[model samples]
Target: MSDLGLDDLAAELADFAPAKKKQATYTAREERIIAGFEDIERFYEEHGRLPQHGEDRDIFERLHAVRLDRLRELEDCRTLLAGLDKHALLDRAAVVSMDEDDLDPDDLMAELSGLGEGDDITTLRHVRSAEEKRAAEEVARRDKCHDFEKFEPLFKQVKDDLANGSRITRPFELKAEIRPGAFFIVFGQICYVAEMGEVFTNPQGRTDARLRVIFDNKTESGMLMRSLQRQLNEDDAGRRITDPAPGPLFADKADDGEAETGTIYVLRSKSDHPVVAEHREVMHKIGVTSGSVEARISGAEKSSTYLLAGVEIVATYKVYGVNCQKLESLMHKVFASAQINLSIPDRFGHMVKPREWFLVPLHVVDEAVERIRDRSILDWVYDPNAGRLVEA
Candidate 1:
């Protein structure tokens, strides 16, 4: 097609108005057909040959046939455009006119001839290859489930010790499974338990929590947990904890509504603890929550020591299609500069549980312990108020 003729056709196509009722019905597929013809014309101009028939047959028949097919397929579209009142046509035409530069007559004709649609065309071969790499990584992670069973005895031992009142030594670490669950123990009685949700306490008396461990029945996570709970209950007769009861631990309380079982665990410092005062200050600065917070203090062994403190608080969050990578990245940055050592299992330490929880351990020396004594982390550890971290 001549450039001027193609331009005139494009202008006509652009001006072709769709009826209000039919405008919403125009599918992407239909638009692709329109765009395909435009591309075919462009291809012909570039190579000096029609796409399908090439220079063998007269170009007019090929062009006419394609246009006729498009017109038939777009009969409803054309009717809709024609039926539009003058004002509506002018309004729609203004927008379509702007897209005139995007039209390709060759592509449009190709779509009409049932060769190909312009919208279906993709040149991102590399993007598809990259997606394959990510898929492979996910498969590896799934297959590499470390043997958590071996740590069972150690967990029992630590739980027993904690039950008997042990002053967990500083910088101590061990991997164990505590009968009902598996956990990484650090600094004696202190343990980092990866349950159904993410919970952490800081040395300066702060807490941070996320939707990792806890389930919200009303939420998508809650539904998955409920299903998993049912499957687990069916798989093991003795392992079932409850008959999928709705509680705060498993679901969030409705707005302005109370939960049948309270899930929120609030940590408060004791009066005698000096860290309590510091915790209150930190809490004010970074909004304390029973769900999320971690505090750290350094400079204990030196006489001229400086108190270094940091807290991992969840600032803002968004749920995007079952992926918790964003939340994990946020938690990693929160603890990045804290200088506290987290006791993680060799197998599960680096791995986050499917339920979306984290096991974090906070450490401090004896002298600087005062810096965190009244702090919220200690309050959480020594006297876990409302949450299930410490058994009543």
Candidate 2:
């Protein structure tokens, strides 16, 4: 009775000792409350004031204010946040409940419908007109351009081409289907259809498509095919933009007294000037004519259009009944960025700007002509950096 064994002593200690408690894990609701409280604490620390609500208040602050209201109403949340109320935010006046008098009907509806949470309830609204429905569909289909920079320069060039008469705008045809990579002018703004959506029927039972319409001003819009069609029809100024033609200029007589076919010609300057010599390989004039190249360059030293320099015909390609003038303009437009800004004195002793000369290689001119022939030049550009033609 006086001395206890080791087993008996251990049993006595175990029975007298307190039970160990399990570690606590936060529930999803508790975690949300903790996060919300932390956000409020951060806001208070930064601004030295609690978040407030109203239309005049910032969106984030309004959200925080709403969150605070919800937290204050929940007993569990208040208990969890009791220790975090170092800013005395919990002791502040309760959030006033918004009634019909305090909020717009639409806002009240939006709040009750959980529309802000990304729930699709578009059908709850009144029936939309054909145009309105199409517009809404376009808005829902909006996408961001990940590589807009790659296309920005191309868009700029197209605008320039349009302004300088290198590209032409014709009436948009009703029969022509809207397709990706097609260019159109709507409300006097040049719109490029960079992307297209799936085929579907509009409320009017007409086939329609959604298009990513990029404008020359760098602004973009998602629009419906029918909507755009209606715009083009209604806005008499709308037009379908066409690529540069630059086919041929002057014509020569054939044996049958008919105009002979044209040629896309590249000519190299024989000038001894510094700029001309420095860029000799790339400095050339591109032109399209149905007449002889020799005749075209004849007396070139007298004309400012030839930079008052004699030009030797470097390359030439024959073509049939295409618009040579349009083709020449197309070549000029293709190499517009590289065009040599040379001002030379004409026979009249007045300085004149020669627009046809470009600081581009002969091979590029050949490729451009080939592309123009195949009607593929509209989709490609001469990348001076790569020294080759690339798809736009």
Candidate 3:
């Protein structure tokens, strides 16, 4: 050692360095057999019985039976599972066998690809776990609404309130914003959260609540709070029904569509009449016009919609890709419940009821326009008492 050079000493040290262990790899077939066996083990744990085959049994159980049979036929599979075969499932006789040359090349490639991608080959065969079965049931339960008669009148009242200008829908907010009385649409069914339990941490550490959710068709479910939230967030069609409020529907500036289509305007009459002066805040004239609002209201004293007097524009929403006539009609319908019920004389001295006159708050009109903008107005109706939009 004393006679050795630096390079010789380094070589000796390298020889004592720890050897790097190579990774263990399995052939495609070996990987597939292991995955198949794991599925069987899980199935046994959940069902408390071995998967069986029969025309009356579930297809998934039959597939499991077939998979088990194939695994037992392969000696290599049994050898690989020797340590993991605590259930002695691999001690059975071979039920089926095929030569390597007998399988179609494409079929073999697909099987290998399915294994590598971790796709459960049994999934296509209608094999499902407990969670999967629950999800399927959720999707299929949309049609049943027990005691729907109790909810039918509620729907009717909402339509009346929507027509009367008492309720409006706004964009939904999350969590703290969603309370016990809120409504939502998930998986295409309108759901109402009748009550909420205390907020608590879920298994994933996210905040959750216990909710009693009533569906539109009369069915109800007591689901975890965030469970509904998760469904809403993950489902493409999930939407919350904004709580109705007494303020403007939307306080934002007019959108770009106003330039192309027309403006949906909320107006308060400047008439000093006792009726108009008393209910000033509640009474409004909601209308749509393709032309300038200022110019349109220039001869306010001559028209019945303006209450035969000059009017102040309280709010205006620019609409795009809309039929102004149809929009005006919709607005008129929304406030029909709150109609002023007064007759005004035109320049010709003919008295006529001002159809556009509504006793709704200015903010309600604004929110209604927002619903129209989002194309959700058609699916919602106002609930005057609840002060929110409910599913139509």
Per TM-score, the best of the predicted structures is 2
lDDT, residue 38, candidate 2 = 76
Candidate 2, residue 235: the lDDT equals 44
lDDT of each: 0.27, 0.61, 0.59
Pitting candidate 1 against candidate 2, the one with the higher lDDT is: 2
- Cα lDDT tens digits, model 1, 1-392, are 55668778778787676645643554443443343444444444555543332111233324333433343355454454444322232122111111111122322221111223332321111223343343233222322214444444544454343222131111112111222242221100112223444445545565433222211111112112232333222221112111122222112224444323111111222222244244432221111121222311121111001111222232322222211222222233332332222222112123111111122222211111232223322222222122122211
The positional error of residue 160 in candidate 1, measured at the CA in angstroms, is: 26
Overlapping backbone residue pairs in candidate 1 total 48
Instruction: Mark the regions of model 3 whose C-alpha exceeds 4 Å error after superposition.
Output: 1-259, 383-390
lDDT of each residue in 1-392, candidate 3, tens digit only: 37889998889899898998897687544554575687678777878777764322333344466667666656667788887777776775422221221121222121111111123332212222443344446644444557667765664454343333354222245766567777665543457776898888877888888877777545777777776776666543355644444432322345554436567888888888789999998788787766678877776675555666788888987766444545676676665566667865545565555566777776677677778656677776655566555676
Model 1 lDDT at residue 166: 31
Indicate which candidate wins on lDDT: 2
lDDT of 2 by residue, 116-222 (tens): 22122222122223433443444345456566776778766775565454665556776364678777755334567888899888788988888778754445777
Compute the lDDT for candidate 1: 0.27
Error of 2 at 151 (Å): 41
Each model's backbone clash number: 48, 14, 12
Ranking by TM-score: 2, 3, 1
Which candidate, 2 or 3, would have the higher TM-score against the true structure?
2
